[model samples]
Target: MRESTTLLRSPSNLASSQRLLFNSKLILPSPVPFKPKHMPCKVFCSQTSESSSTQTLKLISTLRAIPDWADGIKERGMKKKKSLYNHEKWLQHRSSLRHVRHLLSSLSSRVILSLIPPVIFFTSVAAVVAAYNSAISMNWLPEFFPLLRASSLPYQLTAPALALLLVFRTEASFARFEEGRKAWMKVVSGAEEFARQVMANVDGSSNVALKKALLQYIMAFPVALKCHVIYGSDIRNDLKDLLKQDDLSIILSSKHHPRCMIEFISQSIRLLLLEESKRTALESKISCFHEGIGICEQLMGIPIPLSYTRLTSRFLVLWHLTLPIILWDDCNWIVVPATFISAASLFCIEEVGVLIEEPFPMLALDELCNLVHDSIQEAIAMEHLIHDQLLTKRKNHSNEHLTNGRPTS
Candidate 1:
């Protein structure tokens, strides 16, 4: 798998990099340094032996050959791909670190400040309690109320109720995550089926080039979607391979790349369905793509509401505070253990729920963008193989026509 790199450079720098075009490919270095006044660039250039001059000519001619309609498509596709690639890259890059050091560092000063008062108060209370206990033992008053004690009836009931609520909420959040995964699977399956139908039923002889381009689009759309949802943009060369030059031009000119790509995919599907014989079947498959997009959008747009989150957090905090008080009366020594267990349980539930609520975002545990990229590449490769076969068949047909003295139009 090719690793993505982010480049931070000025427009002049970007122009310079584009001109370099070494070996008909760009070599992206790992941990590419970000210069002032530029964004980081993803590194995953091709490795070819062609000289920079040849690469420039090739790029120019390729751009010129792209249809006008394809003008902005490549840029849009690339933006979508890069966003997903970056997110997945970040997730993968951060997986080894058990803790987020940067986040911890930011909190260090505040944590120290918060600890002082609690430390002083607790120490003073302990000293006074010890003195009072000694006096009472020496027959000063009567007896000392045990500082640590177990819970009574109210706490027993409250603990079980809170536990059940936490468990239910966590399970519900997990169910949403599972649904999001299933939806993506449906997208992949539907896209594959639609591509197969087009390849099998469409007339290969009429506009073979256009048909091949459409097939590439079919392969690229889902990959673009995966990138869009996960990383917020596309940063892969795979997009450049699939998008037409005209479309690429338009995407570069536009601001909303993902939405544009979605529009392009919808338009392509519409055009494919305009064919006489396969119209109905193609329409059905297009509907599947639409449905899949809707499902993913639902997952992305509707998260566990903030109201519920606030309520849960408030309840947990209040529950914890009262917990020590309740237990201090009966289970003095055991209060420590009980408090620790309760806090751990509440924190775990909150953490798990938060992770599942946004299934599209790449996490340390996410199925990285590389998975989607690989699947898309597989689809494109299959399309390429089919195109090659079709070309071979055409060549053989032409040969047979010439041998039989027929005109080869």
Candidate 2:
């Protein structure tokens, strides 16, 4: 009774959910179809009809038609670079000066742009202080400028503290980045494994529609999750071709699309014409999806402690603000360029820290989602070919036995 009611829910993501990480189902079994001649597969077996062939071809084309997330999706953040995983290629990228376009369009530019205001402010302070010292010495003007500098003793004493703050801030953000990567890896692997199980276990003509729909949900899960973790993403556009209109509406209308997709998977497993033990085994794979959602939420909902971030920022400003005074005794006017170099270099580290803190933007979620979709489709496309190859081997084995007048046991 409860399982039947799941379909009637207006949106699978209930209007209210108290299970917050942040700030932020069963179906009836269908009747088993009777066995028929030429059952090539115990699971997903069909009569090899023209309609089935056409359906298979249609599925392949539909998968191919879905656009890749790696191309032209820069608004969501992150561009795909093949060399990120290739050490040799990355070295070449680093050594080559020809990638002027890369320098202009990369996340590097965004970080530099963000640093502009602070870098200018601190460098100007250095310039003004240097000029004031000159003006007072030459009697050209009175000391009207603000006293922006302090003794260098504080910078010397707190230098270790600043180092520690920067180190901790960057380390914490990178850890979150690594955590997100691993969580999605689980999701990808889970999707692949679950699809393989469905393709190999769920059998017959009666459940053909169910089998196809189940694969569609498996493919849709990662895309839903990709949208869920990142801001400004619409799941409908991504899933429109992959899922049926009704199912897509139900999932997209839900408050949490990724969780809604998981519910769809659970209900599909329940509806499978499988024994209790088999269904339970299949249902267990949903944990991977859950784990991914939880980890992504944890990273998105909770950031590195605010105290750490604020402390680092304030320390940098104060240190650079007073930096010229400390060097005024020796470096004098040279403090202008020195202050610029220090501010630009140090602030860049913090900017990069902030960039990767959210994790999702830095991640290639689009490509990862597309990989899951492509893998499931690729496996299914090869199914009949694998079966036919096995059939040919079996035929040859039987003929050899007949010729030798023995089974060769």
Candidate 3:
């Protein structure tokens, strides 16, 4: 029976059964490939992390470059702006032919009218000479009368000395003018410095009236000096609002208004500095005030020497008087314009010297005083504004602390 069953199962079936049993004994895997469900998620996470890290590095690099780029742009802009400002300022002082043209263009009708008197005088003198010459040439007047035709040698000899005299005169007057200007500048600087010191050093911000009064005095000092130097009697217009009636009256009634005002200013500063050691600075500034006044008074008292001035005037008169006669022989009608030109030049130079000698009205003291007044007014207003802002900030801070449940000392 066993032989018969073996014959029924072929050789192939026996071999497959043998292989299965062998594989089962060895633990063989399934035919389909093994893959995790989260394999794609892992790949995606790694890729995203790498990309994010690279992007973060790139962002950091860009942020680092940003400030450098901004700084470069700002530097370039500043340089360009500075260069542009310099170029504009350079344009003002350029030495071009326009300067001469400007002078010519500025000649006005008033200038021409002012010169007419000299022109008329020379023209009349020349006309007279021409008429006399014509009479002599036509034999209407006797030639034997010997028309006093003087040589130009005498006039030429006097010219050098006369020129020197005029130059010295003008120089002396210009020196006085320069001194006066410097003195006024000293006054301005001293007053400004004193005000600044008082504003900075003195703890008088609490007393608004006192601070305003000090600033008022600073402003009034220059105005008073201007008034005194220019011989202006009425300062009520300038000081009506700046000062109390009593102070204004004191300044007005005093013979030396500037000195009196300075004394009052000093007294006020002394009172303000009673507890401080900064009064020395005030004294130094007061000394500067005295120096300015002394300089102005010195200029006013000491004038150009009378002898030199008289000599120059005489020389100019004689020169003009003889210039026409000297040129009448050769120039005839032309001498008139020539003499007018010469006389106008000399007289204008002399007049300029005379005008600048005083250095008050001509230098425009009123305008200068107004400028100083405005500056002090503006400075005081600004300081007061700043003080008010500080007080407001302190109050705000204290209120903030109180609101935060803290006590402020």
Per-model TM-score on C-alpha atoms: 0.54, 0.73, 0.67
- Each candidate's number of clashing pairs is 45, 1, 0
Which prediction has the highest lDDT against the true structure? 2
What lDDT would each prediction earn against the true structure? 0.60, 0.80, 0.73
* Ten contiguous residues with the weakest lDDT in model 2: 66-75
Expressed as tens digits, the lDDT of each residue in 1-409 for candidate 3 is 8987886487977788888899897897756655766789999999999999999999987765644554454334322211122576577657586688557854432333344555456566766766776677678887795553578888778779878877888898888888887888788878777888778777764555666687788788888887676653367887787788988998888888789988887877777734456777666678888898898888778778878778877777767777767886778768767877787788667756765676655455666677677777777689889989999999999998889986557
Q: Look at candidate 3 and tell me the lDDT of residue 42.
A: 91
Per-residue alpha-carbon lDDT of model 1 for 1-409, expressed as tens digits?
A: 1222334355666777777876346466656465732532322122233466689988887755533223344224323322334777788667866367654663343222233332333334434444544465567775545433244787677778777767777777887878877777776777677767766776666647656766666666665666556644443554676677887777556665545665665566556534655767776776666676787778878877778777777777677656655655455445455666656546556655765677664232123334444565676578779889999999999998888996558
Error of 3 at 290 (Å): 1.1
**Candidate 2 accuracy as TM-score:** 0.73
lDDT per residue (tens digit) for residues 1-409 in model 2: 7765775453643443322322341244556776743365633444456669999998986654423222224333343321124687667667766487666675545566566667778899999899988777676776674433456787778889887888888888899889988998899999999999888888846688888988999999999988888777777898998998999989868999989998988988888898788788789988888988999898999998898889889889888988999888778799999999999989889977887898887877787888888889899989978888999999999998798996566
Report the backbone clash tally of model 1: 45
lDDT of 3: 0.73
Off by over 4 Å in 1: 1-151, 231-238, 244-246, 252-259, 269-274, 362-409
Query: lDDT for model 1, on a 0 to 1 scale?
Result: 0.60
Q: Can you give the lDDT of residue 284 in candidate 1? A: 71
